[model samples]
Target: MAERSIQEVRAAQPSRDGDGVAIYRVAGMQHAAMDPVLMIDELRSEQREDFIGGFPPHPHRGMQTLTYMKHGGLIHEDNSGNRGEIRSGGAQWMSAGRGIIHSEMPTVDTRGLHGFQLWVNLPAADKMNEPDYRDIPAQEMVTLAAAAFDATVIAGNWTLDGESASGPLQTLAARAGVLDLQLQPGAAVTVEVAPGDSLLGYIYAGSMLHEQRELGPRQLLITSHGERWQLLAGAGGASLLLLRGEPLGEPVAQYGPFVMNTAAEIEQAIQDYQNGRFVPEARPLQ
Candidate 1:
């Protein structure tokens, strides 16, 4: 077991999306080696005005989205006949396989909105498969508690010190996993990751130390190849989202919510949506 070391580090930048909702762009298409992952957006604000507009109906194809909330929530409705709300500490996973129209509106509350929406690219072979959706309540996540940290597995499996826990949404592409970890002050832990897997840590609260580099909040850290990694908490403790998955090694062509393998495919997706053939009762795989 080798300790994973830093390969790259980028701080989140202020950005806007989905009808002017405030967000921090941490990672996206610009970064390569992030196979299976296309984008990550952090939505955090204490003011209602910053997020009131919400995301109106939009079409997505050839990818999956996972929305995890730390504060506030979202009311979700989609053309696939799925409707629900993911409250604070909850998560919603949707794979817009072929195509789907969906809207995620934020809940009005004093807590404001604080959460993340992640996009994962599907393999070319499965890009046109049937769409899948799931709304996981806060209590549904698997919790792993120890003296050093509290971990919630949201979409995959996690094992620490011979103990294991799995989240409710398990059928992720390329074996990707999402974990929310909170470390106590001066605490430390060694996490196991498979070799060649893409491992990233997004610090949202406090700070953390990795191989002598003290990473602050809003910093996205990408780690190099290794079978394990050690996380040491900073003075006031640390909180972060851990993303791990194997590289897809497939070509990706993306155009704002639509991801495919070629430019022609993207064009086809656009035409399909415009022609009202996006979410029919059933469509044969291409």
Candidate 2:
């Protein structure tokens, strides 16, 4: 496969929230036509001047959101009566099947917080299942490293180590790959995907030349088939998230936060929320 041109490299826009820390959003990095793995939004907050508050209770349907903490703490409460507080190294995987409502707030430590919240869209079949959440403490995650790159398999398969998060919420199918990778300087990595699948790379730290284009922090690289992309880290090294998924060939009638096959279905989702038939109050975190 020849090198594909770098599609685009754009920084995540900063979105400040009620919480003090700044939040960067990398929403729908891929074009709507590709139906690529959608990262609806991301948040990074650190304790320094003040705490980073989070989105108040909100609703979600037909998607999954994964939250991993690197530092500080996050307290989560849901209308389902569920409450969970995650500290450094902890993770939360929530699947808003048919629908659910929840809130995530920062703690008052003033130490700041750093983490990533990745949203994955559910396929047509699983879109209406009962919503669920899996809280994984940092200690429960698997960490593996190669000479050039080290990675944590948070939700999907790891071909080399064969270890992954075995919990209630997982990567889902032959359709998804969610990996957090850290590469040393001068290192390069290559990934292969099933034909017609969606592939994307997002730089979180440092920079790299990808698909013949220079990609710095916060930029995403989306690729098509017949292309073998190589990522080279800068002298300071780099960190990023690698995502791939099978394309859902069905028509995508997306409206705001909900994605369905038809506009009428999207309308139903909105009406469900308005009628309060969609809120799945949280269950107390055990």
Best by lDDT: 1
Task: For model 1, name the residue pairs that clash.
Answer: none
lDDT per residue for candidate 1 within 1-286, as digits (tens), equals 7778878888889989888899998655645657777778899998887898989889999999999999898988888788889888899999999999899998765368899988887888989998889999998888999988999899887776567888888877888899999999988877887888888889999999876678898998888888887888898999999998878888788898899989999999999999888877743221
Candidates in order have lDDT scores of 0.86, 0.67
Residues 52-137 of candidate 2 have per-residue lDDT tens digits of 44666667778777777777778877666667888887888777788888778877763767787776777788889887776878
RMSD of each: 3.0, 3.8
